[model samples]
Target: MEYRIEKDLLGEIKVPKEAYYGIHTVRACNNFPVSGLRTHPALIRAIARVKQAAALANMSAGLLDRRVGDAICRAAEEVAGGGLADQFIVDPFQGGAGTSTNMNVNEVIANRAIELLGGQKGDYRLVHPLEHVNLSQSTNDVYPTALRVAAIGMVLELSDCLAGLQAAFQEKEAEFAGILKVGRTEMQDAVPVTLGQEFSAFAEGIARDRWRLYKVEERLRQVNLGGTAVGTGLNADPKYIYAVIEELRAITGYGLARAENTVDLTQNADVFVEVSGLLKAAAVNLSKIAGDLRLLSSGPLGGLAELKLPQVQPGSSIMPGKVNPVIPEMVTQVAFQVMGNDQVIAMAAAAGQLELNAFMPLIAHNLLQSLELLINAVNIFSEKCVKGIKADEERCRRWLEESHSFITALTPHLGYDRAAELVKKAMAEKRLLREVIIESGLFTAGELELIFTPGELTRPGVAGAKLLEKKG
Candidate 1:
C-alpha cells in the first residue's frame, strides 16, 4: 500500500494516495470509534449541497474567484450526487458539535476539487479545505442546516409510507365492513361493533400522523446557514449571507429560509426538540395500534381469535404449527426504538449552551435514524400485516353470541331493571343472555328474535320496539 504525507496542526501523518479524505478526516476516524456507525449518506449529501451553495454565494458576492468557485461547485456536486460517500468516515457520535463531520466534507471536497483543477492532492495552494471550500461557514451553522435538510427529506418519505399504510387499513375496513365483532373494555366484552369500524379507527390514526409529519417540514425549513459561528453573520459578507440561502433553496427545492433571529436560532435547539416530539407522538400511536393487532390476533383457540395475521415465517422451533404475529411484533420494537431515540434527541437539544449546541451530532444522528426506521417499519407493516390481515367471522360471531353486554340493547324495550336482572341471571348460570330472556317470559319469541338480530343489536335505537308493542 502506498501513502502520501498530509500535515495538520498536530503534525504529519500518512494518508492513502487514492483517498479523497485528508488529515482532519483521518484524525476524526482515529479519535472517535464510539458507535461503529458512520454518518448517514443523506446528511453527507446535505452538507455537500450547503458547501456548493456557499461557494456560489461567495462567487456572487465577489468573495471568491470565478474559477475557484466553479471548481468547488463541480466537486461539491459530485459529493452531493453520492460519488464520495465512502470518504465520509467519521462516526455519528462525536464531540465538537459535529465539527469532525464538517471538516470531513471540507477535506473531501477540497481534494476532489484539486483533482478537478489538474492539481495534485493535498495541494492547499490550489484548493485549501478551510480557506477555499469551507469559506464563510462554521460547523455550528453548517451541521444543523444539513441536519434539517436530511430530516425534512426523511419526513416526506415517512409521510408517504404512512399514507400507504393508512390506505391499506382503509381497504381492510371496506373488506370487513359488515363483519360483526364484540368490542371490549378492560379486557371484557362491552358491545357489538363491525370489524370495519375498528380498521377505520386505525386508518384515522395513521392519517393524523401523516398530517403531523407533513407539518414538521415547515418547522425544519428554517435554517441558520448564513449565521456563521454565533449567528451574528460575523465575518460573512452581507450580500453572501442573503445569496447563500437562495442558492440553497434552488439546490434543495425546499422552502428553506434563513431564520429571522439568527442569534436565537444559533443558540436554541428547540426546533429539533419539536421535531423529536412529533416523532415520539407517531411512535406512540404506532405502538398502540400494533399492540391492538397483536391482541386481536393473539391465539387460534385460547385467545381472541377475531383476526388472523399473515404468516410469513414458521413460529416456535419446538412447538409444531405455532404461528406468531411477528410483523406487528417487529413494528412494536421499532416504535420502542423510535421512542428511545426521541428521548436522546430531547436531552441533547436541551443540553445546548449559550453560543451553540455542542450536541448537534447526537441530535442529528438520532433524528435521522428515527425517521429511517419509521419509514421502513410503516412500509413493511402495510405490506406484511395490515394488507394481508384476515377476519375470523366464526370466532367473532361466537364471541358476540356469548357476550352479556348485548343485554344493553334490551334496556329501552324491557326497562333498565329488567335488563339488569336478565344480565345477572345469564352470568350466574353461565348461559347466553337470550336463553335467560326466553325463560323470563318478558316478551314473545318473535319480539325477542327481532331485538337480537344483527342490525338491531349493533345499531343505535330500538328497531324492535314496534314489534314488542304489537305482540303485547
Candidate 2:
C-alpha cells in the first residue's frame, strides 16, 4: 500500500496514504492490542460530537478562523454520522487515562478536515489535530464528556427496552389472570396464587428498573466538557469554555449541562459506578426471573412441569423430542456477564486518583459494554422468552390439589391440630389431602368444593366461612 511519513515526538512513522487516521491513531493502534474490541460505535460518535462542538465553540470565541472551523465541523459531522467507521481502529483497552483514544480522535478529524479543505492527508499545516481540532480540550475532559454522552444514549435505549419487557409481562399477566398455580418458597410448595399475579410482580420489578435508568440519565448529563486539562479551565478561553457545552448539547440533542464543579466531576468516576450498580440491579432482577422461568418450565414429565416455554430449537442430540427453556437460559447467562462487568466498572472507578481519574478508559469500556449487553438481553427476553411463556393449567391444578400448603386455608375450618393430623394421615396413606379430609367426616363434599374453588383459594378471607354461613 502507498504510504505517507508523519513525524511525532517518537520521530517518524508510515501512515496509509488512503487512510483518514494519522500518526497518533497509528501509534495507538500499535501500542494497544489488548482487546480485539474496537472503541464502541456509540463512543466513537460521541467523540466526534465533542470535537464538532469544540470547533464551533472555538470559532464563536474568535480563537479559530471560520474557514478552518467550518471544514473541521464538516469532517467531524461526517464521523458523527458514521462516515469513517474503519478509521477508528484503536482497541477499547489501553493505558494513559484514555489519552490514546482522545489523540486518535483528534488525528482522524484533522486528516479528514485537511482532505475536506483540498489538502492532502497528514498535512497538519492545513488542519493541525492538537492545535485546531482539539483547540481547548484535554483527554481529562474530552474522554469523560464523550463517555457520558455515549452512556446516556445507551441508558435511554436500555430503559425503553425494559419497558418492552414490562409490557410483555403485563400481557402475560392478562392472559393468565384466572390460571391458578401453587407458589413455591425455598423449593417447597407455599400456597395458591394466580399465574397473573406472579407476572404482575415481574412487571413491577422491571418498571422500577426502567424508572431508575431514566433518572440516572440526569447524573450523566452533568459533564466536565470545558474543564480542559484539570477541570480548572486551564489555558482555555472563558467564552469558549461556556460555549462548548451549549454546542455539545445542541449537537448531541441531549440535555447536557456543564458540571457546576468541573474539578470534582473530572477527578471522580463515581457516577459511572452508580450507573453500573443500577445495571447490576437490573441484571439481578433479570437473572432471578429467568431462573424462575427455567424452574417453572423444568420438566414435562419428571419435574414441576408447571410452565411450558416456547421451543425454538432442539434441546438434545440423544434424547428424543427434548425441548429446553433456551431463551431464559440466554438471559441468565447475559445477566451473569453484566454482573461481572459491574465489578470491573466498580474497581476501575475506585482506582482513580486526584485531579483526574487515570482509569477512565476502563470505566468507559466496561460501562458501555454493560449498557449494550443489557439492552439486547432485555429486548430478546421480552420478545423471545417472556412474551411466549405458557402456563400449564393441568399441572398447576394437580400440584395445588396435592400440596399440603393448602392446609393453611382449611385451618380456620378444621382447627390447627386437626389440620396437622389430616396432613399426616394423608401423607402416611399416600392419598390426596382432600380425600383424607372427606374420610374424616369433618364436612360434606359440597362444603369442601366451596373451600377449594380457585377463585376463593387465591383470594383473602376464610376458605368456606362466608358461603357456609349463607347456606346455614
Could you estimate the TM-score for every candidate?
0.96, 0.97
Regions of model 2 farther than 4 Å from truth: none
Per-residue lDDT of candidate 1, residues 199-247 (tens digit): 9999999999999999888999999998999999888999999999999
How high a TM-score does candidate 2 get? Answer: 0.97
What is candidate 2's lDDT per residue for 1-472, written digit by digit as tens? 9999999998999999988888888888898988788988889889999999999999999999999999999999998999889988988888889888888788889988998899999889999999999999999999999999999999999999999999999999999998877888898888788889999999999999999999999989999988887899998999999999999999988999989999999999999999999999999999999998888888889998888888899999999899888888999998999899989988988888878888888888888989998999898888877888888899998998888867888888768898999999999989888888888887777888877767788777877878878867
